[model samples]
Target chain A: MTTFQELRLDGVRRRFGGKDALTGLSLTIRRGEFIALLGPSGCGKSTALNCLAGLLPLTDGSIWQDGSRLDTLPPERRGFGMVFQSYALFPHLSVRKNISFGLQMRRLPRDEVRRRTDEAIKLVRLEEHARKLPGQLSGGQQQRVAIARAVVLEPSLVLMDEPLSNLDAKLRLEMRTEIRRLHQSLGLTTVYVTHDQEEALSLADRLVVLRDGRVEQIGTPEELHNRPANAHVADFMGYRNLLPMKVKAVHGDTVALDGSGLTLEGTPVGPVAPGDDVVAGIRPEDLRAGPHGVPVTVEVVEYQGRELAIEARTAEGVALFLRATERPSPGDRITVTADPSRVLVFP
Target chain B: MTATLPDRDTSSTRVARRHRLAERGIDRQLLLLAPALICVLALFVYPFAYGIGLSFQPAEGGVFGAYRAFFTDAYQRDTIATTLGLALPAAILNVAASVPIAYRMRGRFRGKRVLTTILVVPITLGTVLTAEGLLNYLGPTGWFNRTLMTIGLTDEPVRLTNNYWGVFFSLVITGFPFAFLLILSYLSGIDPTLDRAAATLGAGWWQRFHRITLPLLAPGLATTFCLTFVLAFSVFPSAVLVGDPAGTTRVISIAAYHAAYEVYDYPLGSAIAVIMGLVELAVVAVVLGLRSLLYTGSTGGKG
Candidate 1:
């Protein structure tokens, strides 16, 4: 096990032209942890990954990997494996040659190279295509070959940049499970970057969500999904039902909200003074159909196989999506409620 | 609603239309090739068949007399040896000199545009002008001789112009740009990702170039060599302008021209031209065989 001393970023700054891509951002990554840098496009998640991989030079920062300074090292010298989004396979080489390339570079013996090449091919389940060129394989197969090539070196940290975005849905699911299993088997530290929230939720052991080139929040998947620190985190993690409210009264274990006629029973997320404007965040799946639900006019009802997602507009003109068993048609007057414990109040 | 297929009569008419369309496409293709096909048939095929016929027949009359003289004389056999000797080495030298310049120019820099222009500018200069430039620069009593004299390196001018070396130099200079451009484009067209992947796999620059770049560029090199070889083998203008006519640069084409124009013997000239074509075909076949050995499984000459 490698001990990571905070993987500190001391005022990391990157700029392109006048706009700051990574603006003096600071974050720490624990060793052996699979951290997904989650953000929208152009939020500098990829820029941050490139800096960590030593593929991009930082304008001003110090990055130390396992107590050794990494700023001076080039990508090849960094001793970390990188899997690009494009897979970047050698088109001229057969699958076996591609996997054995790194070992050959080490000037290993012929027998050893052959053994490791077989092992890497087996790891990706591409033994049958060992003699075929990369161009002959499908996109998913090519990506697996890329992973096999990266892992054959046994680097301590593996960096992946939206590696599954190119794959079809079914293949994406298969690769996600495969990547998680491979990560566990090897016990290698991984930094994955993706804009897809479900991908981050399903694959990452911890999520480092970024916004405008700064760390918005960092926690386990459960912490960020259930109790987001702010509006942006909540919205990013699929909290589509956000309503504005004022803190009318605050007491232990329960808070009274003004306007929209709602009282949420939960501990305040952070320090919230009285009369502070706050937004109540709730996942659509948490709301239910009940007698004491807020009166709303159903606008559209979409059946998503297992659950019915109903969009309703309240009398106050605020729209909210309620997931329920009972399907309501458009223009139907209804009431939707949620367990107060699941509601998140953020200022 | 009842499911129905298209009417059979309509479908049959559509199929007939498609058949007619395909026939029209074939006709169009034939039409597109007609001009080149007719030219090759008239000028190339007829002449080649006639040469074979003429070469086999016994020399009886004036034009056939030269053919009879060529086969029976040992002195005429020496021309074949001299032609191959000069052409093969000159072709090899041209190809060898183009590789490094092309490799260096693969990447971009400030003076890259200027350097490329300078390199390609030589191609536009005709063989006559190049020979003239060689005469001015490399001739005895020219700048080269004056420089050697001023440096106190030589007591007299050195002989370079009006020689085989002058012809070879002119060939290399004029032939190099064509080969270089071919090679440079091929080198640059190699997906750079291959090298990046190699680097990530722990291979250094030399290893990557050796294992990947050179092997992939082999087909391109073959094509460039074939083109330059044909050009060198058929050399006539530069040989006449810059080279010694006294048995030095009497390449096959020059011999054919001399027989036809100066010696006023058309049948002998045609015979020599036929021999030159045969020699060229043989050389090209050998070069292609060598190319196949280097790039064993590739399709030839994609460009």
Candidate 2:
């Protein structure tokens, strides 16, 4: 097997009509790496994937693989496989023919096409449905066929656009592990576009957080979860409590907060100065109901089988939500504390 | 109070009987449909049965008199071959030509609505008007022939009307729109993402069309071809107006007309009509059977 090199998207920009969908987007995808493009809808994650796949022409910039230019090529010439959001399986073709379609297009020998198609069907665990049309199969089965159809080609890069978005929760979970396993077994470089943070977090080796067609932060899942660069990134990463507090004093890495009606200390993750307005973020799991903490009035208590989500309002009218193992009634007064290290302050 | 209770019970029983009658209203529903049934029987079934009866009436031969005469006579027997010769080619050409045009016009662009409107103009003209228009447009001194001569494409004016080409062109003019509309609808019903998926799977444009689009559109195409053939087979007005009705384009309808009106032989004419119907039925059945073999229902994402 030949060792694949790297694919680099260099300062890619895309415009639709007069509106910019992507602006100066750049990323490097190494061989056998699983990179997840995570963002909200219309954040240009899909646009970026389309640009790399040559499905859409870039307004400026280029994509390079190894030493050759790929952006100038057409989608079919790019030789990259894409799994669309709709699965987009040929409804009229049997699963075997669907999987063998690319090979047939390449005019491969019939025996080899049959051999690879059989392997792909077994790989996707769809041997029983090898003769079934896509319409006759279940949604999960159809999606498996779609996966086999793309991977059978054995292209260098596999691009998926919200492939699991249409599935039910249970199926999505099943396919998530299936995708991860396939990527590992095939050793194929993959670029996945999804709006689901949890999916990206669990599946991706590296996460690229995008907002408004721009990269907000790019890091490993743990790095993004623990230390998001700004308030927006933190909010997207499940940080529920974002309090706008004025910095009263600073001592090394610790900063004192004011106007939040509490003498709380938070660690400054980004540059901060005295008297500067900073947003202090804390994850719901990090907040604990303890004795030495700020008093809050519990506004809502939502039961979750193993834990409860407690929504509370601070003395200064700042709303926050925290998770608790013990159930608390709404309108009850409680003190919630967060560790200084867990709290992130961004200016 | 006791007297009122007995009376109320009787009235309730009557209401229950009425409800029962309502539930078993099959006869009533048939009665309601009597007018449509009467219209079909009188206007369609009665005439059809009467024509069959007339065809079986004994003439010079016996019970199978008219049919025997038609098969024995060269002119009448040749009409079937001639009509089919013209209709089949015209229908096939119309459907085959419409596919690429419909495929190109499936997506929206500037002047799409106007183009569609223009395409359907021939259908709106009807057979009579289309024949009249073709007579002038395709005549010896008509603009079509004159233009060819003026452009030095030909030394003399070409003969276009009152021949096989004239009737063929008229059938195409009328049938193309019908086939085009049907093909366009089938093309539009397909999800565009299917083609995009094929493209990503290394299929070029022609491959995508041949594998995905053509297979999916098979059923619609067969149906459109049958309809257009039927429309072309009964080409009486064009055959008489812009065709050599006594020679090349003496189609089945013209023969049936001459038998009934000119020769005053209604039995022979009715016999010809029955044969025409049987031939159409055979073609339609064959086409529909082929459609079943080719059609795999729809295969794409639900729109």
Candidate 3:
């Protein structure tokens, strides 16, 4: 077993012309940790990775690997492995040669090179197509070859940028499982970047969600999914129901909200002034259909295999979605209830 | 009953007429190729066939007798050897001179367009004017020698005009731009991304050029070689003007011109021209066939 090593970025900033790509972003990656940098497109996730890989010059920052300064090192000298979003495999080389390229660069002994190539090809289960070029392989197979090439060098930290985006749906799921297994087995510090929430939640030990070149939230998947830091994080993590509520009164642990006859419960996660307008968010699954629920008219009913997505509008014209088994069709009046603890209040 | 049976036979005859109409449509399509075929026959094929026939025409004054006599002569044999000697060196020098200059000019800098224009001016002047300029500049009592003598670099004027070097200089000045343009385009056409990739993969500048750039440029180099060689081999005016037509610079094209224009032996001239064309075709074929080894088989499709 190998000991875990740490990677840290100190004030990393990247700028193109006048626009900032990564603005003073800094994070620490633990040894043997699988961290997912999750965000929407153009959220500076890829730019951060490129900066970490030393592919781009940082406008201001320093990168330290196990306490060694790495900001000035060239990409090949940085001692980090990167699998690109497109899996930028050297098209001219065969799968086996691609895996052996770094080793050859190191000028290793011939016998060791052959041994490592075989081991890498076996790890990716690409022995059968070892002699074939990447173009001849399927997208998933090319991804495996890319992973194999990155892993063959056995660098301390591995950075993957949307490696599974090119794969088909079924193959993506399969490779997701494979990647998780490899991460567990290899115990390498990894930073995986993706725009897909499910990909981040399913594969990451901890998630770092970014927005507008800033870190929105950083936590475990459960922490992000359950207690999002803000409305943006909640909306990004699949919280579709956001309603404006006026706080009527605050008493001890409970707060009364306006425009509703019933009192709403929340964790008071953010600062909220009494009688002030605020936003309350709840996951669709947290709301239920019951007799004492809030009155709303159903706009649409969508059956999504295991559950139903009910689009409903309140008497005050507030739109919301509630997940439940029994969904009311369009034009049907329904009442939706939410457990007060499941609701999130933000100012 | 008799009228109904006759109607059925009439319908079958109409079907046969339609089939004939379809056949005529196909005939017109085939006929559309006739004009192109006739042009190729009259313009290209007829001249080539006539040249071969004239080269092989029998004895006395015509046929292969002139070719046989020409080849059998010692002076003609020496001329062919001398032409090859000058042409090959000039071609090689022309290609060599272009590679570095074009390589340097591949990237943009101040005065690049001006330099390229100045370099291309000699090509626009063609071989004859270039040869005249070379004669004026390189003559024994020309500006070059006079300056050197004035500068005390040489006590006597150097013999630069009416020699093999004068013809070679003319060829280089005129042919360099063609080779340079061909190679500059070739070098620029290679995706710069490939260089970046190589660099990211731990390849240094020279290694990237050698391993990636050189292999990709093999086809361009081969083409440049053949084109420059053909141009140099066909040196006629320069060989007659700036060169020693009696001694050193009597090339094969000069031999053909002498046969056709001076001696008024059109058959001999045609035979020599046919030989030159055949030699060029053979060289080009060899060059192309050899380049197959370095070709990575068209980087576009999945190999």
Name the top TM-score candidate: 2
Write the residue-wise lDDT of candidate 2 on A78-143 in tens digits.
888899999988888888988999989989899999999999999999999899888889989988
Error of 1 at A111 (Å): 3.0
True lDDT of residue B176, candidate 2 = 97
Give the Cα error of residue B300 in candidate 2, in Å: 1.8
In the order shown, the candidates' DockQ scores are 0.28, 0.65, 0.25
Candidate 1 fnat reads: 0.42
TM-score of chain B of 2: 0.89
Candidate 3's DockQ:
0.25
Worst ten in a row by lDDT for model 1 chain A: A1-10
The alpha-carbon RMSD values of the candidates against the true structure, listed in the order shown, are: 5.3, 3.3, 5.2
Per-structure clash totals for the candidates = 0, 1, 2
Candidate ordering by lDDT (highest first)? 2, 3, 1
Report the candidate with higher TM-score, 1 versus 2: 2
Q: CAPRI verdict on model 2?
A: medium
Residue B128, candidate 3: Cα error in Å is 6.0
lDDT of 3 by residue, B173-280 (tens): 888888888888887866554454444455566666776667667678888989998998888898889999988998888888888889887778888888778777
In candidate 3, how many Å is residue A91 off? 2.9
The DockQ-derived docking category for candidate 1 is: acceptable
